[model samples]
Target: MKKNKAHSALLNRYQKLINISCDLASELDLNILLSKIVRAACEVSDAEEASILMYDPNKKTLYFQAATNLDSQLKRGLVVPLDGSIAGWIVNHQKPIIVDNPQKDKRHFDYIGKITSIECKSLLGIPLMSKGNVIGVLEVINKRGGGFNKEDQDVLLALGAQATVAIENSRLFLQSDLIGEFVHQIRTPLSALNAAAHLLKSNRVHEDQKKKMIDILEAEIEALAEMSSSFLDLARLESGRKQYNVKEFDIRDLLIVCHEIIINEAHKLNLLFILDLPDTLPLIRGDRKQLKQAFINLLNNAVKYNKIGGEIILKAIAEKDRIIITISDTGLGIPEDERSKIFEKFYRVKSHRDHVPGTGLGLSVVKQIIHGHGGEIDFTSEVDVGTTFTITLPNEI
Candidate 1:
């Protein structure tokens, strides 16, 4: 009777794994897929916590990619040395390891435990292998009931195999999608440059016309440069490879600095800039530099799109558990039909496209940065009235 019951449990566990494998295969978003992988790892192994450390072959380094019971942002892309880490050992040997007490193990990297404040009493780590190469390590910490056993190792290893394939597929999808869009977007600027150069060399071009052609060449060149830089930023963000330097910072100070940076340009356009902020606001824990970039993007947009004698408002308020920020501009608001697509990459507002000089990639970068910090971004607009972008970030990580 005992033997039959054990067999039934084993079958059920395998059945669950099969379902999870299907789910992982269908997920394309790298962040969502990593979360699903770690969650499934914990469920399959009956462990208290699980994490994934991705291996970067080019850098020859391993870094934390996801975790079940920790703020992943705090540790994402945090490097684990190959010489003194269990995850590193698993990757090096391309084998699994079961440690009953990680504290007693000299090879354990305690820095991670101290940094995350998550005690690692026990661990079972397996190498994630694809195409005969170790791509990463998947580890489950503090197995339930007792120390990890061979069955736990076997199940996690099985899951790791499926996870490896899923990760590679997701990465390939990101590369191909970004590359296709980039190739298509670059052609327009390149064609303009070619046309301007050809016209400048023609004898029919008068002196004034030649100067105009030179101006077009310069503008087109600048657009291509901006487009390339923004394209790379979006690519890094979308691929889950961008390392965020997380820290606690005063939101008010950051906003003030952003306001100062763009106030001159706002004034140059005859726009009244208002900073409506509380004297004191909550300190937000995130990557300060990335957050600064997000704020600057919004502020620049407000100034860029505003009409003469209009007003730009930068406002912030703190809620019980979150910070609310809004950047409003009395400019050409987006049309109702195009509002839904504003955050999409390389999408420019149709009516303003011809007159405005922009790469249409700023909002996409801002959205990615905000989402990466465990925040939300939304907007409300009315044609010829105004537009407002609201960003909500957590009070703590």
Candidate 2:
């Protein structure tokens, strides 16, 4: 009877693995695909939590891309160096390891434990390889009933193999999709450049008209340059290759810095800039530089979309476990129908497209950064009444 029960459990696990393999093959969204892979890892391995650490060849480092145990996205971009890290060793040697007590393993990265606030008692890590290339590591932590065994290793290795292929396919699909959209977006600016050049070369125009044509050329050139830079930024972020330098910093100070930098520009438009922040606030963890970029993008938008002499209000408050920020502007608000697409790539408000000079990529970049930090961003707008954007970042207060 005992042998029969053991055989049935083994068969069930393999069956579960087969179903997961089919599920992974159909997913094309990189983020969703990764989440599914990790969750599946936990279910099949009978572990408490699972994580996927992807290797960035350009940086020669590994970063936490997805995890089942993390409470927030604070650990997503946390870097694990190749030296003195188990994940790094797996990537370097391209093999599997079963460490029953990570505390005794000198190769363990204890900093990660502190960052995620999760203790690692047992760990089973496998290298995710594809086409002779070491791509990343798949790890399941703290097996439930007992230490990791050969069966657990066998199952995780099988999952990792399928996961690596799925990841590569998803990345390729994203790149192709983004490239097509980018090509479509640049055609308008290119045509404007061509038209300006043609008008400048003709002898039939007055000197004043020629100056106007030169101005047009300069503006279009500037727009194209900005578009190129923003495109690269979006691509890197979407590909998950962007490295974040994580540190603990006060949100209040970051807000002040942003206000100081943009206040002059707001003044040029005869706008009022107000910063309402508490004297004392909790310090948050994450990539400070990326968070700053996210804030600056929203602030710039508040200014850009506002009417002359409009008011921009920046307020912050700390709750028990999170910080809330709202940037309100008394300007042209987004339309009801278009609000859903605001964060989509290359999407611009139909009303503002003609009068406003923009690439429509700023908000997309902003959304990516905000979400990557394990935060949420939302906004409320009324036509001509104004718009207010709310951001919430996780904190330990």
Candidate 3:
């Protein structure tokens, strides 16, 4: 009777934990979801602290995304190797582990203690698995009272399952939203083309006026055709219908090609163009044509948004195992809040909406192409200080 009672109590506790996990998983905000997971893990496991490590597949490293007791910003982006660490072991095995004394374990990594300046006594880690693959590791360090037990392990596993489902759902939702926006963006150009065709057919205009109208019609038609082709290419890359053609190419030479292609336009604006690239750059593996298109789109934006007599700079450097390329301009900068949405398909900073004309798919297409190559594109801008777009691609490819 006593044993049965004990088992039932444990089961009830686990049920409550599972319910909390489900609630946390429903959150779409990445930061909130991470915080809730850490809090729930600490509560259910009765641990002193909890931390979530997200796996970056491109870097093949584990990074701290959130923690209950550590400095959140300090812990963020702290990378851990894939070998010789407890978290790494869990990731590799896709299983749960409970260590009562981490100091005695050969697999325990002491580097985290040095980084966070916190001593770890015990640890319970479980792999966050989705679709039969490990995405990351969730861990509770130093039980508050006694050591973690089988019930704790079971509860954490259940929580991991819920978190995985939620993460997968959020990713899918983001992708769907992007595709919808892409579809909506193509409509504007299509409408312009239709109007131009209708005007050309009208006979009310004089010969000189008709000739000018024909020119406008031709330009609009060409814009529509170019936008359609670019949109289709972006859609294929985003939907995984097409794969990146990765290869080794010189970064400097690529920038020179972009400058050569856009030199006339730069001259029209009277903008001084500068290129700062090293004489010998390591070979970067990526689709050369796609990357060139991304550069051209960014350079075009710089030129389009610049005031007369402004300057544009193309800079490149090798950082760690990644190559960083930046295109900066003395043109109008993006607003702080608007920076986040710039990569969304058909999204343009409100500041540029009236002053500049674009299909709004340029940055989105750039983001997709960079992401397809397993790289990242981000920017920093001050309202009047100007914007600089930084792209980081792996040195290997």
| Per-candidate alpha-carbon RMSD to the true structure | 3.0, 2.1, 8.3
Whole-model alpha-carbon lDDT for candidate 3: 0.79
Give me the runs in candidate 3 sitting further than 4 Å from their true place. 1-12, 56-61, 70-77, 186-268, 272-303, 311-345, 349-397
Scored by TM-score, the top model is 2
Model 1 TM? 0.88
lDDT string, candidate 2, 1-397, tens digits: 9999989998999899999999999999888898899999999999999999989877798988888877435577778889898999999988999999997899999986785678899999999998877888999999998999999999999999889989999999989999999999999889888877777777778998888888888888998899989888899898887877777898899999999988998999999999999999899887888888889989999999999999999999999889999999999999999999999998999999999889999999998888888789999999898999999988731
Clashing pairs in 3: none
lDDT against the true structure, per candidate, is: 0.89, 0.90, 0.79
- Please give the range of 10 consecutive residues that has the lowest summed lDDT in model 2: 69-78
Candidate 3's TM-score:
0.58
- TM-score to true structure, per model: 0.88, 0.94, 0.58
The clash count of every prediction, one per candidate, is 0, 0, 0
Error of 2 at 259 (Å): 0.8
- Ranking according to TM-score, highest score first: 2, 1, 3
lDDT of 3 by residue, 230-304 (tens): 777766555333434455688778988998887789889999989888886787766788889999999999898
